[model samples]
Target chain A: MRIERELMRGAGPVAVLKLLERHEMYGYELIDALSKRSEGVLALGQSTLYPMLYNMEAKGLIESTERAAPSGRERRYYRLTRTGHAQLAQQTEQWVAISRAMLALGILPGPTTTQEALA
Target chain B: MTTTAPQHESPPAPQRLWSDILTTPVGDLLRGRIGARCRPRPRDLIATCGLPAELASLVWEVVRRTRLWSTEKVAVSRELIAHFEDGLAVGTSAAELGVSFGDPAQAAALIRRAKRRNRPLIWKAAKLAENAVAAVLSLALLLYTIQVVRLYSHAPNITRNYVSEWNQDALTVPPAERAWPVYLAAMQATNGYWEHNWHGDELSPGSSSWPDITEFINSNGRALELYRQAAAMPKIGLVLGREPDVDYMVNNAGQPIKNAGAAPDPNPEFISVLLPPLTTFRSVSGMLKVDVYLAAQAGDAQRTQHNLDAVFGIVAHAREVRLMLADLVALTIAGDACRTIGALLRANPQLFDDHQLAQIAHRLAGLGGPEGLRTRFASERATVEDFLQRYFTDDGHGDGLGRPELLARLAVFTSGDPAPTRWTPTIGLNTVLMPAISPFMAGKREMLAKCLDFFGRYEAEAATPLWQRSPTTVDDEFIQFRTSLRNEVRYAPLMILMPSLGRAGLMYEYFAQQRDATTAALALALYHRQHGSWPQSLNELVPQLLPQVPPDRYDGQPLKYCLVDGHPLLYSIGVNRKDDGGRLPSPPPDGTKTPLAELNRQARRWQPAPTAQRGAGAAMEKPLPDGDWLLWPPVE
Candidate 1:
């Protein structure tokens, strides 16, 4: 199922930052990777994703540069900045804690192993 | 995943119209400024690609609706096109991609907000300033409209007629006892010949103008007799608009009445009520001086005393007007009479007996008695209050706003230029605009208070003796008080109504000194007659020939006295406030001392020099000439 808008608003930037933390990605590449990896649950529209990237860049959480792809088409690439990396680490910890609390209250299914739940 | 041909889902006309609106001149100027950093136009790669017309049109629609910087629109367009193209390669249908893109308006708004946040700091500040200016202009326009309504609704209520009130005493005088008619006849019979011929010099036998002087005396014998008869009367009894007599009206009304057929309005506005011109009185006093000099030359002490009495009468008549200007004229006439007395005593010392000398001295001593030297500001205050009433609206609590139409009327009256009989477009425009601006000016109560405060301070300062007063007192205070930008705007009516009385105060002091010196000289003359020699000092003449020694008005000291060349020399430490051992101002290059009459002229013309700096720069500066003012032996 698709995430609710408010939850997506919180999750979207962290997801993008996590992807960019691995390697720089253009707009289309990031969208494709997010859909496949999150099984379309964390998917964002072209309308929402571009503005989100622009806002993150404005806040210095991400930076963008224009470059030519191997296909000879000009594309904009985004990457995590030092601030973005720190924000991702902090948000990841918060998400982990939230999952643990949900499991303790039986709102989420208990993990088969503690390691599985943490992962 | 498989690709399908793009579906033509949305209409094309609306998008084209929106695009056309953004390219207008004003829009283009704004866009160029907002997009200043977006240089080297980006190629529309989506147009070159094999994208369906529907998909390409959608991308252009969203970009156009954003209304962002051109560079930002291009970037957004490129990214969206690439996202769609990538989706197609991944087997997403074009119709499904369009549905996922959501509303074009919402997307444009979101992108626009985010993009604006990334704009340069100067651009953001400029946009803020543009909004602020618009808000301020709107507020100012609203306030102006409110003020316009307020000013037009209110009008001045003139309850009291100040002119009739001012004339009450003069109107109550019995016609039989009135001296004004005799004075008027004297003025008519005098023929105004002295006014045209005399160049403001003493008309003694020694004067260069003595030929005209003899003719003037011979021709105006009847006029001189009338003047003496008027002088001997108990009351001046001058009333305004009582008769249509031209010279009488001109003397008391300042100007001839325009509509002579109509009786003077009993309750006329105060400003329109003319004050008596001092010129006629001053001219008559001047003629009387000539009469006194001629009598003294003939050694006729009785004629001299009668003529002197006429001069004093004219002074009292002028003083009765109760105006600062009239009082100044009175002092001036008194001073001229004193100087004439001094000249007579010096030239013809044997002209009068001991009794005649004592009488002359007593009359001179009383010329400007204690209250005479004080400039009265009551009439002046009344005039300003009357002006304020006419110039502003009264709300009964003594507070009200200015009425610009009345101000314009006052301007026309005081300017001495006749106002236009017919209204023109310029007058109409002034009528419209004056009310709009008058609300920002001083209201009646504040203006009255300011005027009273200024007059109060000035009168208090003037009451003190010259030596006790500050160096830069009345005139300096007036200049500083009136010329400030804030005061000029707020107290404009007060500025217009108030006369410059500072110099009038100084002039009163000068004339007071002249009167005192003449009294002491007359006393000395009497003592010389009795003792056959000048006294050892001015003290010997006191209580016998004089009541008390008159102090030098310049420094508040006893008048300087000494025997020079075995003749009594009398003088005052002058404006410099230093004793120069009774030495006079340096003589002319010919080594002849300036005649006392010439010295008197110089004294009247004197003005204080600017104060010098107190430190080292003062030493390098040229100092003002320090001289004693010679009063006795007549400087000749």
Candidate 2:
């Protein structure tokens, strides 16, 4: 199931920063990872992903450089800057708190066992 | 349930007119030239990808719609092509890829906005400044257009004819009482020989030009007789009509009539309506002076008295005009008469009998009295009021904005140049600027108040005695006020209209002293003729030779009297207010100068020390001379 457009707009930049925080990624890699990791709920088309990347780059949240891939194709890769790393950390905290509140309100499923909690 | 992602769709065919135009051969050539100039080495990765023609065209359409800076457009093009290539690398069909890409127009707009945000700060600031300048220029143009419309839509309503009102009093005087016709006749009877031949000091019997003087008097007997008859007339009654311009009549005509037949101007501009010229009256005074000197030289006391009376009559006639300039001319004529009388008494002591001397003394004593010494500017105030009405729009409450066209005309008029017969660059420039300047200028009511305030101060200052008046008075105040940059803009019209009256005020005082001193000298001449010797003091002549001793105008003290080399000397303490004990200024170290007027100017302390010199410990470059103003025996 896809999230609503308004929810996606709020979630988009933070998700891109989190992905770029781990390592540098290209546009197709980011889109594929977001789709699989979120069970297709965060799936974005080329049009949406490219514009989001450009906006992040403009805001100094991420930087891009064109380089040769292992397959010998020239691809523009994006990486999180220091500012993006901080932003990702902040957004992660906000999401964890929101999930806790949802769980408390019985809107989200609580952990079923001790193992689940530990995980 | 699963939802399909949005597809990147091209614009409908009917909305693709711009795209169609760009595909034309000429458009293609222009595009090629622009592309070479803007993106000299653009990368085309789509061509290498071997993508289908449809997919390739989609990438180009998306990039073209961005409409960003050339460099930014090229960057967007490269990135989009790279993204598509990566999609195709994953074994995705061209159709599936195209379906998921979304609207090209929306993407182009987003990319363009984002790219602009990333531009260098200098470029952003420059763009902002460019936009701001365009906005301000548009606003200014709009405002200027509105102002021009406002200026042109309204017209000045000149309800009053000031010229007719000014001529009303003169017109009421009966023709029989009018002296102008007789004066004109006197002017016509003269041969113009006296005007051409007479120079300064020529009226003196001892002057080298005495021959010319005798001939002038001998030849113009009828003119002299007419002058005497005109002097006896009850009133000047010179009606200044509309036509035959005053200057033309006075300066050009052989016999300028008192009233030209032209009707009064129905619509007259006050400043443009010339005041009746006093040049003819001034000439009459000059001719009468020559007559006085010659008659006195011939020892004919009766003819001398007649000429003196005519000269005084001309002075009285000039005063009736009520103009400050005319008043000044009248004062000058009176001063000349006084000087001629003093010279006559000194040159020919036996020429006049006791009764004749008493008559001359009385006339000199009553020349201006206390009232004439004060400069009158009532007519000047009226002229300014009239000008304000004609030049400004009437809002029915005595307040209105200046009409730009009339203000421009005034500027041209005051420049002392005749109005341009055709459009010139200067007039064109004035036309353009007048509207812009009109908003900043003072309105009619405010200008009138300022004018009244200035005239009021001037009249007050004129009323004060010279000895009691402050050095930094109306003249200095006006100079400082008018010359300031801000005031010059606010009072632009006033700066053009107001004549300088400070020097004229000083002249009035100077001539008043001359008249008084001449009166005293005439009395002294009478005292000597009776007693066979000069009086020991000016007080000795009181109630017999003089009703009372004339006070010094510079310092309210009685006129200084002393015997110099067995002759009676009379003088006043000059502007420095110091008594040099009836001593004249020493002759120039170089030699004697011929012109007595120049000598008198050099001898008299006409002005006090400058303000800068009056400050504590300020050393003057050359100190002003401390000299007594020698009034008699006429400063020979």
In order, the TM-score of chain B in each prediction is: 0.80, 0.85
Residue B565 displacement (Å), model 2: 1.6
Q: Which residue pairs overlap in candidate 1's backbone?
A: none
Residue B563 lDDT, candidate 1, scale 0-100: 89
lDDT of 2 by residue, B124-151 (tens): 9999999999999998788778767766
Residue B293 local lDDT, model 1: 77
Off by over 4 Å in 2: A1-11, A28-59, A87-119, B1-58, B91-103, B193-199, B241-260, B368-370, B421-432, B543-548, B586-596, B603-605, B608-622
Best by TM-score: 2
Interface Cα RMSD per model, in Å? 1.3, 1.2
TM-score of candidate 1 relative to the true fold: 0.80
Please report, in order, the local distance difference test score of every candidate based on alpha carbons. 0.73, 0.74
lDDT of 1 by residue, B129-241 (tens): 99899899888788777776766677778877776676677777798888887876676666445565675664556778887787877788998899888877866776654
